[model samples]
Target: MSPFNNHLEVAGFEKILLLKFSICVLFSVGVWVIYTQKARLSSIPNSKKALFFLLSFIILRILPFLIIYVILDFSARSDVRMFYDSALGALKLGFVYRDFETAYSPIFPYLTALPLLIWDSAKAIVLEMVLVEGIILWFTYKYYKNSLGNYYLLLYLMLPAPFVFSILGGQEDIWMWAFVLWTCFILRKNSNWLLAGLIMGLGLLTTKALLVLYLPALFIFAKKPWQFMLGLLIVGIPSLAFMYYHSELLFLSPIQQANDPRTPNIWSVLHPLTNGFVPIGPKILNWVGLVSIQALGIFFAIKSKKTSKPHYFLVFLFLIISVWLMIIQQSSLSNYAYVFLMPMVFFFGEQTNKKWLILLLLLNLFVVIQPPIWWGIGMPIFHSLSDLNSGYKVLEYITEIGVVVLLFAFLRIIIKNFKTTNNSNV
Candidate 1:
């Protein structure tokens, strides 16, 4: 069997039994490590302790996942496999567009292939991801206030959504988030529009969602727009030139992705009423959502002119992301919401108001927590709870609604922040 085939290994009673045994052993070790390290990590001076905890957590979690996944040869996501194939096509097959029906931006094929270059093993790719996540979380801790640094790190690692997505799903969203956070971190210290723009450009190649960051970049470099454009063009021009040779495949992902129907988004509720799984949507609403994204982007860009603080831009960014999640039909996966959690932890962790924090936690748990046999049994047990159901259709709609509620709550917090900031300025 091909290693990349997801259907064969992830199914069957034997595979489930093996996976369960591995998880049980790994969980026990993780608990033991935490218990033993608690005192030792606490004994370190506050200045140095966060890094200690961060690395310890990364290893304790990553080591088990690395071993189990390799032993089982668990399926990497189809998206990853597709990107791998696209990369191979690029490298050995002359990188033709229709060759693999490449749907992603030009740079992604190369980015995904970097791990394959290091080691032919799937574990190596996952390990590289774990390392990159470690760095992102470490800097997140570094930039956040010391008192809440450990809290944020623990929240990130222990969260169910992030955990499953990182280890099992092997989603590439973290790479995009890491680049955006790094860009913002640098901009926080100095006004380097060129570097920030370059980072944004690079990030876009990995995940189109990073296009949202352009709002903050525009505001930060409002006076130096030329520099921002120059930096963007530096990276973007080459990709465009490469795509020119690759032909129409450059536009395929964006076009098809916009209409692709996944679940657990606002569209889930509407899907039954609309065309069934045809990757189409209400044309008018589509236009509206697109306009709203741009309108909010422009608003944030204008509002950011008043304050030079990077937090102002971040606050605006939080709102823009919420709007994007709320409106974008393409964002059907619950994991897409992971983009908001990092910024939330950094800015809201220290806040006295726990409403948004609590809501976000509930949201993460609702989306991430899953029965062990979800894939093995072909569906979660909850679907059978309602006999009136059409194969878990009701449950899917409920999950999507829950996500919508959490998003609106978050939007309220954003509005409150803008009001408070305005009042303080006056």
Candidate 2:
């Protein structure tokens, strides 16, 4: 049985379950309204648009949690329970890597634990997540406001995937992107390379180790590699020293995380055929994926050297990360799609392709609903081949295929842009 199930009250569980279904229904209605009233929404004043988005975000994301945990006094489920466990463990142990094990960065457990210093409840960790999400949303809006307009923000806010993954699952996959977005804002001046590197180094320490995969894009785009490297070393050295002082276990976290079960990915889809065995094995596939991402980053850098546009950079960065998520073993959960939300909005906001937009919306719907269906039926959120059921497996296949198609479409767009840039240069 799941840990949260042990403490769950029947009345609370039923209420929360009903609330989840209601939120999904409301999200569907909101999407329909947005689609039918696009012209009317676009005509609204910027101030009102911002206010509406904020209010809607709070209602959909924040209020439900407040109702469930605060008023209803229910135990949080899914990763939030694990997060609370890690925080409490950190508080008791006093050092994260040394005294305990966590797949997250060294700072993450402590950061999650910070809220407990105030309220001393697991709900505090969820509140901390909300705050982190708010920071991410604010940075995303500020950075993309002029380039993409309010429509992109509207879509991001209204999207069910972001709400489900970030709020309901309490996943922090997008936390790394928050620092990336802030660095994007800083790099707008072109002379802030050092500061950007410093911020990224801090991100490396606090957020997912996957942030390292994004470094190639930053390095390729840097005006002065030496200055950026210097700034990275400034924080990198101290962070490394701190980790070393704590324990050698700190360096093993990534390897440990890599052994986690595969999810909503091609490997998982093919698992039944292989009888839950990979012909090439996961470690080899992981290395191949990493090497492929590095090669793609280099190829994109070469093709787009003359294109210093910020939006193009976002596209390339998204491509690199998307490739990693698509191919890498043990790393392709549907929730990871949240990382693509901001970049997708910024990259495709002006495109008139209804097919791509429709595909994206369908992908979000499948991704959002899959979790609830699986959990509601007592299936594990991240499952092995043996754990699969026909009901949940169908959604998994659809969501994975949709992601693959969407990613290929993005690649086509990037290639087309590259060709346009080259022809214009000639």
Candidate 3:
């Protein structure tokens, strides 16, 4: 690279960061002023105030992710180990119609390709991510506006992890989750079923994380088959399209799956463990892990005195996890960390105290590091299991360690909840 060109890129990227930082800071101050200016939150009881503070504390805890990722991009953005790299390759290598040869739904990578075609720079692409993320933020705040006051909105503002996905890896994980949530809100309002289905379906194609949506959809649409069917239709069409076009090529090719050296899900990490150690298939372990966690949660959930639409959401999450881990591969570290959100939103809404909140926060920290380490941590773990000398070996090891601990942790919580519930019944 020419020194002049290098200098220009550095100068230009710095300018962009300065501009973004300025805008974000100003926007944050405006939001804070609007929040404090009103008497809406002032009238809340002292306890709610405290709960609000703790929740916001958790959100703010990850706020520095933006700065760290912005720097990481300079060095690691081109790293082939990133999931985004594989997704992007499908587009950059001209495999749009033959997405099966690559991994994942082609839409996200195609979008990434679009931005790169114009600017050919990671900074510009991430800026686009920030913009899209900002829009999602606006709608997210809107979704909770009626249910949450300033305290809750503050948590949304500082939601460190989701924001990090946008700022750092240029990941579309948040959008997938956000769209699925939007579909839920729309369904709650009795809005368009086809649109909702399409929204969720597209979310599914983009990231496996949205596979969680299908769990909720199953029960909600169990009796209402049409809605469920419609969602499947919408969600599956794009993926099927890729499959149809690439029928000669392998579907769900091993190479595509092999891209991730570490994943807690059976496809990437579990099967390898069995091959290296036990004769058992990782799929078997996955089903056992998922179903065991699920059955206990659902059985307890149904028996609990509390039965509401929101409670049903928890059941939906339980089902999602059951099927997701058992069936899908490539569920990432952040994906597992996402499980903590369930307890936080659920227990907090139930008026469970700060102690419960703190416990889940600690658990969140634990689970957050599981599988396909997001930022280079799990490489060694992956290497240990896949091939100790390979770059991704450590990723497997950590994934193995993480999964064992998480499996035990998930079971422990379920048993604890069950025993507690039974004792209360007695």
Candidate 4:
């Protein structure tokens, strides 16, 4: 059977199963090689190390997907199709939210559609995402080279979540963090608060609206709060005015998304008990989740205010996003964990204990595979209350439990690191 829906039947990609298994083996070997050769790699020039990292990422993450989908004509599956449809819709309508319905922010559809102008295929969207991921990875390496070292890049590439979600699934979640990181990079000198804020606001416009959750923490951590606020308002006011004039659909998009509850969230776990019915309804749950996330962001901001270390800000950022994934109504999929993968790896990768690192790897594995199980097994067979089966129910419960455990594991790591950092300071 072809992976991701019988590509054997549709796309006629021969030996696809072998191809996939080979890619998996190769990725495992690549990771092992990097791990064992770390000492030798440390002695190499930074430029050479950077080249090796990029090449490894391409060979492991990019080439396999390209070979399967582009070279062999395997059909694009999952959210990439939706991304293509939204982009095509926006192209046809000449407007994103006004002309067609999309849950994404105002600028995303346009950005996705740009590639379609030349390539005119869904593959173009995947390639566009790959390009963006590459740029993000380059910048990440550049920014963290001195502090975290090249191992961070290698670890990030080795993680299955980024490859599965960003390259294979074509998710835009990581783009949100890419923007946040770029903002941090801009303000690394502690002199560019206004520019950083403008960049961040632009990121919010282009990426998911949830990126706003990072604002409170960012404001608290910023050296010049007033300047950042001014820059944010500069971009935000014009963007809001343009959105209001262009599309009433923009305002209605979030409400529309709230009606459907996704899997691997708290709501999904309780869905079996509720029989897909809640007394409060999904909209209320949506607001409640948002408020809860915002409250946590504010709390973390206040708690970490005294600590000016950049990594702590990232920890709080990861914490806030973790809370969002755990409780948010529309966050239904674990793939959104891509947003926090950077901080998780950067902070937790240095652990002397292998247990936390091992656990993190297992969680990444769970996250990478959860979407396929939910989509292929749970959604198809157990979508409706009447359709549920005992075996499928057990599998669904296990996946949900994995999500909950992953959330708690992240919280634990964050707290541990926080205390360790403070104690070292003392």
Report lDDT (Cα) of residue 90, candidate 2: 82
Best by lDDT: 4
Q: Where is the poorest 10-residue window by lDDT in model 4?
A: 2-11
TM-score for each prediction? 0.76, 0.82, 0.58, 0.84
lDDT-wise, the better of 1 and 2 is 2
- lDDT, candidates in the order shown: 0.57, 0.65, 0.45, 0.67
Residues 283-348, candidate 1: write the lDDT tens digits. 655565567666666676666666645534654565456546554654346666666666665554
Q: lDDT tens digits, residues 1-426, model 4?
A: 323343223234324323433444555556566666656655767658667776867886689667867788867666888889889887885677767767788788889999999999888888888788878777766666343456667767877667767667777777887887777667554658888789889987888877777787678766678999999999999878877887754655854665676667766665555666643244777777878776777676677767655444654565556646554555457777887786566545555245765666666766665565555453532333554444434555676768767777777677666656532211
Candidate 3, 141-204: lDDT as tens digits: 4454233444444533433333334454454444554555666566556645566666667766
Q: Name every residue pair that clashes in candidate 4.
A: none
How close is each model in CA RMSD to the real structure? 6.8, 5.3, 10.2, 4.7
Model 1: worst 10 consecutive residues (lDDT sum): 379-388
Q: For model 1, how big is the CA root-mean-square deviation?
A: 6.8
Q: Name the lDDT of candidate 4.
A: 0.67
